[model samples]
Structure formats: structure tokens, C-alpha cells
Target: MEQTETPPPGRRVALAVLGLSAMTIMANATVASSLPGLKRHFADVAGIDTLAGLIVTLPSLAVVITAGLMGWLADRMDRQKLLAFVALCYGLGGTSGLWAESLNAILAGRLLLGVGVAGTMTLGMTWSADLWQGAARARFLGLQGAAISVAGIVFMLTGGALAGLHWRGAFAVYALILPVAVLALLALAPYSRERRRAAPVAKGMARQAGFPWAAFAFVGSLGFVFQAAFYITPTRLPFRLEELGVANPLAVGALMAALVAVSAPVSLAYGRIRRHVSAMSVFGLSFALIGAGFVAHALAQDWHGVLAGSVIAGLGMGLSMPNYTTWFLARVPMAMRGRASGLLTTAFFLGQFASPLVSAPLVAHLGLAGAFGAVGGTLIGLGLLLAVAQIWWPEQARPETAPAAVS
Candidate 1:
């Protein structure tokens, strides 16, 4: 793999931006460890079970609704300013829970946090597309996944500890984004302005080429399924653990951390994995691992078995996430990266928002283990179908094109 050298402040700045991107995951997972606490605190609220779940899903819902518009703005506006502004909002919205006295107010804060997430996520990947190319791009995307996994462990543990003190304490983790906002302003602002001036016409040219609607749809659908499957752990596992006689938030955090911790190493190995397998094949393998993990979870009679299943699913998550973004980036032209990235973000989070709804019925009828078995079976079937399709239609499975331009 040829490494394409990027001009200017180089890998240091790129790494900083990537580090900031980890905050997006923190916003979601940090709250997971706090869910049990929140549920207890708001025990009087009607339908509290569903409302407690909303604390986690609301941000994703906001992301799904707003990411496309944010992406569109990224292509036409100043990305640095957009990112920094959103980072500020992310901190404020996420931390609003600390002072909010009512459930509705807290939900409002999560909604605002979602808007911030939509922009930061859309712009973060667009920046990667703009700054690097070839193997470096692939490596950076893998690093993005690694960073998110590492952040998940740290934030989940922090949130769990804080939740033990008070549910509001976990909300304080959102305040970390304030410093990240400052870092983005200092590191990314100047370079972003320079890039904007150099390629004022890139957006128009990209529009002229027409959006790759078919490719966007394909990637979006795949993202939806993968994310829904991945979300089953954070959204439902705490409750599942309770059913198996583990009610401690810290223990739940550790188990969830184990899942993401396994993912970190696998994500870092993604560049190497791509060396031996086509992106399509990698996708197939990811689904297979996820399915098998779910099956393991379904059959678990104890938390240890659940942990094993989580680790397996984490491997699938680590590989598939980077693969999805890398595959989308490769297919889209430079001008369309922001919008395309936004659509991908929307699809992924939409799946997150839908995970509970999709699984709750199964939880109601079949129990958690049975739900896992059902989802696992579906994913394994999907994986096998994709593999067979790849063999039968290699050309469609692996389309060739000139490398994306490094703007």
C-alpha cells in the first residue's frame, strides 16, 4: 500500500481531530452506565422504562434527523467553525442533565446534544477525507474506530463510577467536550479556512457529476443493520444482566467495557485485515461474527457467557465500522464526501434509535436470550447471503474506480 503524503501540519493535527471524534461515542456510551440510576431516580414517571431508554436514544434520534443537513452544510460552509460550534453545543446539551429537574427538560438537553453530534460526526469524517489519501486514509479510519472503542471503555467506567454517586454525576462527562471545542478551534480552524479558499469550485463540480444515489443507498442500508445489531448490547444488556442476578452498574460497565476493549485491538488490526480480504468479504465476516456473538448471548446461563458473547460481537463491530466508512469513502467523489458521510451517520444512528423498538417485542415474547437468538440468526443468514452474492457477482461486489481525490 502506497502512503500518500498530505500537505501542511500533517498527522499530528489529523490525530487530534480523530481524538476529538471519539467524543461522539462518549456522548452515547457514557450514558449507558447511568441508565439504571436514571431509571431508579425517575421511578415515578409513567412509562419510565421507555422514558429511561429515551435518554440513550434521543441523541441518536436527533442525529438521524439532522446529520444530512449538517453534511450538506459542511460541503458548502466553513467546516472548522461548524465543528467547533457544535462541540460547544455538545458539551452544554450533554451536561444540561446535571441541573435539569424534570425528565422533559433532560430529554430536551439530549435533543440539543444530538444536534451537536450530528455536525461533529459529519464533519469529522469529511475532514479525514479532505486531509489524507490511500493507505493513510484507511489507517486513519481504522484509528477512528480504535479511538471510539478506547473512549467507550473509559467513559463507560467513568459514567458507572459517577452513577454510583448520583445519576447527575455521569452527565458531567459531557463537559469534557468543552476543552475539545477549544482544541478544534486552535488546531483545525486555520487549515480549514485555507482548504475552503483553495477549492471553492469543488462542490459545484461534485454536484455536476451527480450524487451516487445507488451507492449511498446501499451503504446506508448496510450501516442501519450493522448499527442496530451493535446497539443491542448498550441498550438492552444492563436490563438483561439484571434478569441474571447482576444489578450493579459498575459490573454492567465492566462487561460493556470488555466488549469495546476487545473491539479496540480488532479495530487497530483493520488495516491488516483489508490486506487479505476485499471490503465486501470483510463485511460478510463481520456479520457472521456478530450473529455468532448474539447466539452466544442467547444461550448464556450466566454473566460470564454474556461477556464471551459481547467480546465476539465487539470483534465484528471493530471490523465492520471502519470497513463501512472506508467503503463509502472509496466510492464517493471528494466533493460529495460530507453529504455522503452525513447520510451514513443518519442511517447508522437511525438503527440505534430503532434497536429498542425492534428488540423490545422479542424481549416481551421470547426473553432476552431468545431475542439474541432471533437477531443472531437473522444476521448470520444475512452474512451467508452476502458471501454467496459476492462469489456469484464479483464485479458488482467489488467495483473498481480511480482513487478518491485528496482535497
Candidate 2:
């Protein structure tokens, strides 16, 4: 039976896709509350502090390597099946740390977890673009972003409580994602059969145009910078709290949750905002706010300042998430959405993986506060320049609407 080119998302399909989106947050930050304890647990090992930090960010390294490939596969394969398989990988790999006896073992599990992330996130987004266009796409992505932030809030609180019990306990939360694999398979079964008949057409369309490398480089850079700067909150915030004399895992979780909490409303409002301003203008404003938030963190005397920084930065983050995805999708051809989404995912995760590597040395030399100040300063300058450029060169401000998917 021939499947319609792009069916409207039914409840199950929508849930499966959005559920996959939520896991992207759980993929990394679910363990954020445990970072300090993990460091303490592995204190005997040299450079364990840095290695422990990797537990949160290391899946990104795997995503950096595999997201492009996963994207490519999505264009050619049954994305529904692939997404389901990866969800299983996400569950198994994420839970491995729960039983890991050594830091190396845990890191190995993180790499596998990254592979799962590359597939789930990339394919979930590809499905979104496949299923919707224009205003519908924008609205769905906004809802998707909000769902992710809400998941982050839940996972942060859950992880923090788990970490308080035992650092390993936090890893168990990952197992909860196991059911998503079944959900994807059952929800997408009809699409899988329908899409199979359209495979040849998709393949033909894929070769009609060359990949847009230059355009992607610009978009990719935007994603990278946003991630690198934003990751400072998850990767280092716990230690920052420790320095400020708040060491409880639950407290760290609450603060991190607070950071994500504020982003939810901003994400929900993204559709309205996108209608009024260019994506570039939104990026400019978001970056400026994030920079200011970091500055607040740098000057903070207690957790109150951290809370203030989180709220400020969270708003920017909310704007940035939906904006980046929308901007990238606007440029992607329907046939090539998979590969493009994968590459964009890679760019984003590469920034995440690079964050700790870059920040560790900065923290070593400048101290955490000074490091925050320096990064905040750079982002603020860059944000202002982007804003000014958007005003002077309005042509670049307005994004082209995405090419409509073939039916």
C-alpha cells in the first residue's frame, strides 16, 4: 500500500516524536546533579574531576562523530525503526553507569549513550520537519522545545534526589526511557509501511541538489557557540555552588532545574516572537541576555545570584533552542532534512563536548567566577555586534520559509 507523502501526526506519533525530543535533555543533564558526588567518588584517580565532568558531556563526543551518519541513514532507511532501536540503546547505555565499577567503564557507557542521542534527537526532529510546514512547523517546534525544558526540570530534580541517595542512583532514571522504544515502534508502524513505498522518490530528490555546505557552516557555527556557552551552566554550575558553600545534590538540582524552568515560557512564546523578529535578531537578544546572566553568576555572592543568573540565561536559552532548529529547517530541503538535521545536531553537541575542555583551563587559571566573567564578556560583545548587524543588514535578518515537503 502506498503511504501518503506526509501524514498529519496522530496522537501516538506526536507523543513518540515529542517523547524522543524530551530524552535529548535527559541524555546529558540527567546526571548533572551527580557530578560533584561522582568527582568525590572517583577522587583517587588523577584528573578524576575533569573525567567526572565528562560523564555529563561525553555523549556529546559520540554525537559529534555519529550524528551526521545517523542523519544520512534517516534519509535512506526506515527512520521509525531506527528511532526505536536507538531508544533502546539510550536506555541500555544510559543505565550502564549504574553498575560501572570504574570511571573508564562509566565513560564507555556514556559514549554508547551518545550514539543513542545522535539517532533519537536527529530522527525525532527529522520527523517533525517531515510532518509539518510553515506556521505549523514553528508551533510544533516551540511545543517541542518547551517539552524538552520541562523534561529537564523533572530530570534535574529527579537526578538530584537520586544523587543524594547515591551517585549511581541517578543513572537508573535513564532506564525509564526503555518504554519509548516500544512506543515508537507501535506508533510509527503505519508510517513505516507507507514511507517504504516512497523511498525511491525520496532518494531521487536527494540527488537533485548539492548539499549546502557554506550555508550549513554559518548555521552550525551559531549552534556551536550557543551550546558551548550554555553548557557552562550544567558542566560547572555544581562546583560553583560547592564553592559558594552549597553542596547538597538536591540544591544543585533545584538551581539547575530553575535555569531550565524559566525557558519553558519563553519556548511557548517562540511562535509569537518569530512572527515579529528575524531569527538573527532573536539570537542577538538571547545571547545578550545569556551573557548578562553569566555576568550575574560571576558576581554572585550566594545561591540567590545563581538563581538570578539561571532565570536570565534560561530565557535566552528558551529563545535560542526553537530559533536554531527553525532557522536550520528553513534552509533544509525536504529530501535532505535527515542529513542536515544530523549535521546540525553534531555541531551543537560538538560545542557541548568542547565546553568542559575549554572551561577547565579557564577555571584553572581565572577561577570559576573569573571564567564566567570572561565568557560572559565575550558573549555580550558578540551579541551586540549581531544585533547591530541585523539592523544595518536587514536582508540577513529574515529567514526564508522552509521548502514544503512533497506529498
Which regions in candidate 2 have their CA more than 4 angstroms from the true location?
1-8, 32-54, 98-105, 163-167, 241-249, 392-407
* lDDT of candidate 1 at residue 150, scale 0 to 100: 86
lDDT of 1 by residue, 306-341 (tens): 899889988988898888877777667677788888
What TM-score does structure 2 among the candidates reach?
0.88
User: Candidate 1: RMSD over Cα atoms?
Assistant: 3.0
Error of 1 at 84 (Å): 2.8
Across 216-242, the per-residue lDDT of candidate 2 in tens digits comes to 888899889989988988778888889
Consecutive 10-residue window with the lowest summed lDDT within model 1: 395-404
* Backbone collision tally, model 1: 0
Which stretches in model 1 have alpha-carbon errors above 4 Å? 1-11, 32-50, 242-248, 395-407
Which prediction has the highest lDDT against the true structure? 2
Task: Give per-residue lDDT, candidate 1, residue 225.
Answer: 92
